[model samples]
Structures are given as C-alpha cells and as structure tokens.
Target: MGSELRQAFSVIRKAPELISPAAPTPKEFKKLSDIDDQEGLKFHVPSLFFYKNSPSPALEGKDPVKVIREALSKALVFYYPLAGRLREGDNRKLLVDCNGEGILFTEADANVKLEHFGDEIQVPCPYLDQLLYNVPGSDGTLGCPLLLIQVTRLLCGGFILGLRFIHTICDGFGFMQFLKAVEEMTNGANSPSLTPVWQREILNARDPPRITRIHHEFEPVKNSRDIFLNMNLDDMAHKSFYFGPKEIASLRHQLPFHLQNCSRFELITAWLWRCRTIALEPDPDEIVRLSFTASARGKHYNQLIPPGYYGNAFVYPALCSKADDLCRNPLEYAVELVKKAKAEINEEYVRSVADLMVIRGRPKYTSEGYFIVSDNTRTGFDEVDLGWGKPVFGGIAGALLIISFYLKYQKRDGEIGSMVPICLPLSTMEKFQEEMKKMTEAPM
Candidate 1:
C-alpha cells in the first residue's frame, strides 16, 4: 500500500490467533443447503456498520478497542463457527470446520472524521483493503476463514465495523442475527434474543430429485463473475433514492383493487425493476427477469424453519418477461407479476428448488437478462445498537461484491421516502437518473 493511503487508513493491530467459542459449539456434519452449494456462492459479502458519536460516558475512561475485543470474545463462545474455517466435504460441498480457530480481528484508525462525507455514510468507503483480510485464493474460495472483522475508530468518536463473510456461511439475514448476538454480549445481555440453529439438512432436496414447476432456468456451472465486474468501477456511481411511508401508501392505493394494499416492498421493487429495465434499454425480444428473494424462516416448510435458524433459508424467485413487454406493461402489471412470483414459493416450491439445485449443480445464470433486487429493509439494521447509539449507516448496500447492483436501504428519520441504492455504469447512470425522476416524481 502507498504511504499516503496507508497514512489515511493505517492498521493498528492484527490479531490472527484462533478466538475459539466461549464454549465448544456443536461439532457435527452440517450439510449446507443445495442453494448454498452454488458455485456463485464463492463471493464474499462486505458489510459496514456506522455507530454515531454518543454523549454517553461509556468510553470516557476505557479503551474502545479493548472493550470491543472482550465483547467479541464472549460472543464467539456462542458463535464458534465464525472462529472456524471452511472445508470441502466428499460431495464437493463446503461446511464449517467448527474448530476453536479464532476469527481475524484488526483494529484500525482512520485519519478522517465521520461527518466529512456528509449525509450518506456509505459513500467514500475506499479503505476496504485495510478493513478486512484477503479471503480469495486458488482452488476456488478455499482455505479462507469464515469471518473477518475490522474495527476503525473515527476521529469524530464513532466506530465503523467492517465485515467480510463467506456467502455459504449464511445469507444476509442470518448474518444480522450473528451481529445481534455480538451486540448483546457487548451490552452484557445474559442471553441472545435469537439462538443460532443449524439445520441445513432440513432444506435438502428430495431423494431422486424432481423439478415440479420450472419457473426460472439456470445456465450450466462455469467460472461465475459479477454481472458487471468487468466494467470500469471508477466511473460507476453508487447512490440512494428515498420514498416515505405516506408516499408509499399512495403507491399502494394506486394499484387495482386486487393489488391495492400490497406490501411496500413489493410495490417499490416492481417500480424499480421497471425503471432499471427501461434505463438499460435492451432488445425488445431479449428476455428480462426481475429476481427477488423469499425467506423461508419462521414458516412451515414441511419441517418448521424457525426465525433463529442461522443458515441460508431463502429461495430465489423471479418474474420473467420479454424486454419489450416489460417496457410497455402498466406499472400495476409488473406489481402483479412480482406478487405471483411470491405466491409460487410455498413449502413444496422451496423444497423442490433445493432438490433441483442439488440434482443439477448450481444453476448457471447469464447476466444479460437478469436484474436482481433484494430488500435491505428486512435485514434489520435498526436493531444493531451496541449501547453507544443506533447505527447511522448499516444495511445491505455493502453486501454485493459487484460494482453494479440495486437494493433498498432503510434511511434515518426525516429522510423522506424509502432509500433505494443503485450502483451502475456511469454511462448509463444519467439515463437511469432521468427514468428514475420520471417514475418517482410522476403523478400518482
């Protein structure tokens, strides 16, 4: 690293010793979800939580790094898998080693203050290299620890916790649960609000797997790449557009009687899907799909899937259409399509998808016709308060490794509307802005 940049973001300490769980966690053969076994799951998630400066006196006489390390050590007792490493099983699938190996914890000091970037804290996050250790290597995402964390104390007295997690370890939802556990330990909470459950076997495919309803198709597995990773990242821009509860209510009221009162998530996703597709302006005959995820947690999936089940329990369901048709369809039509996609994902469908994935390696997906939208609002960032104060910027915006992707982030109060963050090729951003203004500002 250059001296100048290093000065801007300097590492304080690197603790690489195994921080084993406070106690020995379960050591069993934990089979991962077939979906979790996807080749594309090789990508690691990047996350950041921004806790604002507090007027409280917790850190008045104590060291922030020392306090955080102690809390994390306590939390690790229950979350041992994090302290472990990833290993490949006989079936070529990956599972946690559950050894007492500790997670890589690095404490850093950033030269800049938190407020220097102004309103959105997610932007100007350029010191990602100093935040987390490297996870990728030869033999495909192997030989890497399951979790890595970097705690940076800002000059403004705030701290940023940057996380890098293997996708197979858990989806974004389950990761939040782990963070909450650590936060609880930090607060001296006797027990976690949600206990970790590892029943990946529950989502296993049926014997002699069968495909009941073929809604979405996947390409053969090969080397997977981010949809727009090859593009120039320097020119790409990341931004958030917000809509309020009242404005969202208006949107829900505008839909037809059958569709009226649909969820804020459904409406926002449908609207954004149309806008993005329109901005891309692809061929009329080209097939385009709006990919949305459905969580099976707390639902009766043949076997009960508890809310605290810390694993990948989400099903990938999407609405597909010809680019031409999607562009010409009414807004409500797209909303209806998204609703139907959600309806199709019952217990049988989710289980069937799992079975199908196991039978056929991970479904190979072509990026051209795919537009994925995940709801960050449900990831529950608001609940991750570490006793200092609530987080100013914490959500799924940092989850994707791709430079270009879209997700909805929960904004702080007084910030009107739902915050939708988008990262797209700079060339297309202007057109996207025009289309976005037209849709968001158009008469309801």
Candidate 2:
C-alpha cells in the first residue's frame, strides 16, 4: 500500500503550554454542575480528530497553533461551563465547579502524515493513548479539568486534535456540540446555532425517587480492576473491517421482512453480537450481553431533554441471552432483541435510571462476557470544518481495552462505506475471523 508502517508514532509537546485565565482560590461553592445518575458510565470520554492539510483560513498563511489557541479562548467565553474543574460534591458524587479554571491546552508535533492514519484504522489505536490527554492516576472523576485538549502538527502540515472531557460534564453529543461552537469561533461566526442547555433539573431523580419500573437490563456493576487482567494484555490485537454500500445493502436485504428498514446501526450491532457470541463459544447457561448507548437528544425524553441539552443524556441499553441461545438463534431474533432494547429509551426509562443510580450509589460495571458498542456514524465529526475542509480521521480513542467502533468509513476504495474496529485477544480474534467469514460469506 503506502510506506512501511511505523510501529510507534512520536510527538513532542510545544513549549509554554497554557491553562488559560488563572483563577482565585475558591472555598465557597457559587457555581456547581451536578453529575446525573446514569446507572453506569466512566468518568471521562476521550476522542481524536486527525485533519489533513487544507487551504482554509486557520491553516492558511497564519499559524494554525496561534489561531487555534485564540479560537479556543473565545470558545471558552461562550462555553464557560467547560472551563471548570472536577470536584467532589454531596453524597460523594462528582460535580463541576464552574469556576473558570480553564482548559489544559497543549501544542505538539507528530512524526507521521495524514495518509499514514486513515489507510490502516486500527493500527493507529495504540498511538491514541499517547495522543490523548489523561491524568496518569486520577479517578477520572475528580481533580481533572472538565476539558483537556491537545493539538499536534504532523510531518506534512497535517494535524490531530485530542479532546478528553470528564463524562459528567457532557456525553458524546454535548462534546460534539461544543466542538461545533469552537469551529464557529475559528471560522469567525458570531455564535453557534444551538446554545448549551444548563437545566439539569429535569434529569434529577424524582423527589421520592424510586425505580417505578423494574427492568432487568440494568444489572448491578461487578467490580473488576482490569478488564483483561486474566489475559496477557500485551498479546491483544486491534482489528478493523470495512463494509461498503454493497455489503450493507446485502445484509439489509437478508434481514427479516419486518426488519428490512431497520437503522444501519441496529442491523450491524445485531450482526456483531451474534458473531461475537458464537466466536467465544461459551456454555449454554453462560450469559452474553450486548451494551450500546442510546442518545436522548431530540428523540426519546425530548419533552424533558431539550434540543441543546448538552450533558450526559445517554443511557446504556443492554440485552442478555444465554451464550448457547445467542450463538444458535436466527439473526432476525437477535436483531429483534436489539430493536426492543432501542425501544426502551422512553421518558419513564430515563427517569427510572436516574432513580436507580441513586439507589446503586456508583456501582462498578462488569465487562466479562460483554460487548460494548459505540456507533459514531452520525457524530458530525466530518462536518467540523474548523477552517480545514474536513478531518481525514475523527473518532473516539478506544475508551476501554475492548470495544467495537461502528462508524462511516473514511477511506475511498469503493462507494461510501462503514467500518468496524474491534480490539480482542489474539486467540479470540482467530475465532472471531472464522465466525465473520461464516456470516458474511453465507448466501443472502
């Protein structure tokens, strides 16, 4: 394909980094943003954006670094909530003190080019940990800025932006909404089309909070220090597969008559769940779970959650089946289960989850025999024209050791396509490939 792949990417942080607009020591709580009870979620969401060289104003004659820094500063004024610090509140829950402590903004230089990135999607994951900003040993809930950003210039004028936001501050939707605002500032727009929604009151647990509807999907978290602690961590491999319009259309046509018009995300997720469970080959009694996030903006719970409501408005809807049954079930059965999980995201479910979190009081989530899926197909990352035409690669850094990334394909070998990047143990990947072949090669 291109030049020989480099094993490790390199970077050097530019000097004199700024954590803008220093603040006075605060003991009193004048401004506080509370973290909602979402049953379970991590403390931080890490994302990456790799942009190719372009002739836009920000990348034109002026220095991109300086322009970005200035634009971010202006952006902070509008999105003032982001320039806060994570602190503990009542009940040991996390809350943001909107004290304007400012964001940790760093500039760096990379040794790779744009083409080196998109060509092999999964290959770049290991380097992502280096590219993103994470406090080495923080609980990810406290003592870290709500927002941390890194802009790295690459060998061929290409650059990558790293964004890590404390989850309590906002979910993926809110984060992208924030980026859209910053992009406007970079492009000299007066303001964003959607303003940040600050009313967390609607999402607060009921006054006499109780789980009105008992749903078995919300399982108590099983604490595990490391997801792959039992396996040799170093032996794991990250793999990616691309499926074009032809493949997606083919899969769609093969679905049950009732599911013919199912969303692409649901179709692919259902297919992935069946494939993964079969590949693992667990006992009949052993349970397997598929957990994916469902956004609550402009959709379910819309009456309670406004259009610009930029916070953790996502709930992880899960479905579990015996490993044996999951492996043997018709694809349509699993697909229907996925459809049911998607349908459970109404206003009652959202309110009940908040109440359940109150009861659980921050429980740990177990990853054993579980597959967490994230579909970035509509992330609007491709439209973030921050003075650049578009980013070559824009997606989340693998949040966990094992995750399935579903997003629109970035490369151009065929018609507009979709891609799935999954990281698994080497032994498991071998079996996974076998199952993938069996499913994809079967006649539609």
Candidate 3:
C-alpha cells in the first residue's frame, strides 16, 4: 500500500510567489521574545491540513486557492510580522523586520483524491515533500520568508494546505491563532475577532538575569547517551500508534487505582518514555530524560502574557531518571515523574528559563537520552475551518527523529483517541512495538 501510494501521488506546482498584505501595515522592527530566538527553535516546522470539499452552498464552486490566497493577504495586514523577513542583530537575537516583504505562497494540483491516502492519513506521510516543496534557500532563519504556504487542489475537489513556518516566530498555539485569522478572512470577516498583539517584551529576560530554578533542559552533557548522533537517517523508521478507548483502558488497567486517574498526556508520555528507553537498550546506569513543553499563556502568569500575543511563551520542562530504574520501575513511577515535571512550570520557572537563556548563551535543549512528546490533541489543529468544512486530517505532516506529537484521532466508530507518531532505529522499532503490544495486550 505504501509503495502504491508513493508511486501514484504526485503534485504539479506553479512557480512560488510572494503574497503581500492587502492593506498597509506597520513599518518597523519587532523584537522576538527570549524563548522565541532560542537555538532549539531556529528551524522551520512543517504542518499540513487536508480538507474534503464542503457540501455547504456558501462554499460551492469556490476556488480554494483563490479564496485562501486572497484571505491570506487580508490576514497578513494584522499579522504583518509574518509577511516580513527575519533578521538577526547583535548577540544572535532574532527580530522581524516587518517590512511587508510578503510571505512565500504556492499553488499546486495533485493527481490523487483524498481517498487515495486512506480512511485515516497516518504520519510520516509518504508524499509530504511533494505536497509542500521546500524551495531552495527558504528554510534559513536569517533574512528569509518566515511563512511558506502551499495549497494543493485534489482531483475530488478536496484541497490540502501545507505550511512551513519559522519556529522562532511562533509556537503551536500562536501559529494556530494566525491560521484562525486567515479562516476569519475566508469567512468574510473584515478582520480577526481577536486583535493581533506583539507585546513580546512581556517574556523578555530580567534586567540582570538571575537563574532562580534548576533548568535541566539546557544543561550540557558530556559522554551522553545520544543514540541519534551515531545513526544515519536511513536506519530509522517512523510509525503512528493509535490509542483508542480499549487501548487506553488496557493501559489504565496496568496501573494502580490511584495512578489510573492520571491525565492521558501523563499516562502516554510515561509509557512511551519507558518503552522507548527499553527499546534503545542504553546503559542501565545511564540517565534518560523525558522532555516536554508546557504553555504559560493561561497559567498563573496569564496576566503577564495577554491573549493574541503570538510568540514563543512556553517552557521546556525535563525529567531525568536512570535507564535501569525507568525501565525496571512500575508504570506509576514514570507517571509520578511526569506529573512532578509538569507541576513545576509556574511563572518563576518560565522566568528562570529566560534568565538561563541569557546566562548560558541561549543553549539548545539537551538531546542526549531525550524523548520529547508534544501534545497537539488539544491544540485544535483539526478544527480549523476555512470555508471548506473542518479538515479531514490536520496536524504535523510527519514525525521528527527525536520529538513525537500526540495528535487527535477519531475512528469510524466515532471513538476518539490520541495518535502518537514515533521514529526509531529499525531494530529498536521492532523492540518498541513489542513493548507497546505488551502494554495494550496486558490482561485486565
């Protein structure tokens, strides 16, 4: 099936062009938050949303490319920073020039229909590159288009929107806000219901930066258990694991009554971290870390970061444990660690991370023995409506080598769950699947 899909799917794209704002916007430079310009967020992140043709009379005979292109131009008037070019100043601090340079846009036509993919589109999509072409020299962080979008029309009137945005510009929630703005324009709204805000200074470092908390996320490690460093890309495989109601029930059954009430994110992250560590077969005494980002927007610091502030406003909290202990302990052991790490992300924790970035020269998140899980199930990526009804499939186009995303999934029977995409070495993948099977197949 994979080979056939790969052979059958193809996209014929037009020359990419710039889409500027429909109206004039501010002509000035906007500084990025400390969390925005971090070394870990210096690259582009890709996401794709597939929309089946809507049956609504309002959307009938609508050209998605034309509607979206025009709507994007209008949306950029408020999100002008996205239409601008990124520039780096002294200290490697990043800022948007906000010069109305326009964002990269492309229109394409695909040979296949939505059904060609399958009932459910899985991650590590085979034709992601074809769907979203990476134009030469467009992925850099300095003086380049911050947002790149491609609209691919399918044979069955469905369309796929492919986006590649600079991570430094916005986090997942912020990006979704921008897309929602575009959706508002497509629906005939004059402007976004929520006004765009660029008060990035709210997340700036202190006058004299002071590290108030221990931030293990940025700690440098020597002689680390970095498995990916020695392995080539070809040796790894990506697969999506679905956790439906039954599977979740099975997993819950494995835990004690008290631990069974843990949130799905904690349960899944703990299980995957332990299973992944066992699969890698790292040294028993070696330290393994589980890293995840927690948003501070609506937390205790909600008053600090106002709504519509589209920038990086999250903290990377990491939990560490010995491989032997992590693999040998009960499921509750891992859950407790995850809960502890998540509970520590208060306002002070965020401030300390910002201070740490300045004090440590903006070090990247440590990758050694790291298993990162990002929960997108609640991000509302799937619910984005743009004239065409909600997308059939939405979220990250594929999985990264080190980071996995917990995406929303709904089965034909209407059972809703989470879909996690994981990439691992081929040999390790087999072992990982075995571990996962054991968890799901365990007796009630």
Best by TM-score: 3
Q: Provide the RMSD of all predictions against the true structure, rounded to 1 decimal.
A: 4.2, 3.4, 1.3
Q: Count clashing residue pairs in model 2.
A: 0
Tens digits of per-residue lDDT for model 1, 251-277: 676577888878877888888778777
Q: Per-residue CA lDDT of candidate 2, range 1-444, in tens? A: 233545556788754344653233333332232235332455566767777778485458655677677877777766776776666667866666667777777788877777776555433365675576454543365666677778888788877788777666777777888888888878887667787776776777777878876554456334412336577767786777666765677678667788898887887888888877776666667777788877666644556678787777766766887777888778888888889888766777777767777776754455667788887778776567778666666776653565666666555653566677777777777888887776567676
Off by over 4 Å in 3: none
Please give the CA lDDT of all the candidate structures: 0.67, 0.69, 0.88
Q: Which sequence of candidate numbers ranks them by lDDT, best first? A: 3, 2, 1
For candidate 3, write residues 1-444 as lDDT tens digits: 556877877899999999999999989988898878799888788988988878357768989999999999999999999999888888978888999999999999999888888854757677788889998889988889999899999999999999999889998999999999999999889999999899898888998999998877777565676879878899999899998788878878888888878988888899999999999999988888888879888857757788898898888788899899999998889999999888778998988888888888899988888878888898889998998998888888767888898889777677889989899999899999999999867897
Which parts of model 1 are misplaced by more than 4 Å? Answer: 1-18, 23-29, 55-60, 123-140, 190-193, 217-235, 246-258, 300-303, 399-413
TM-score per prediction, in order, is 0.86, 0.88, 0.97
All candidates in order of TM-score, best leading:
3, 2, 1
Model 2 alpha-carbon drift over 4 Å, by segment: 1-9, 21-39, 57-59, 116-118, 121-126, 133-139, 220-232, 299-302
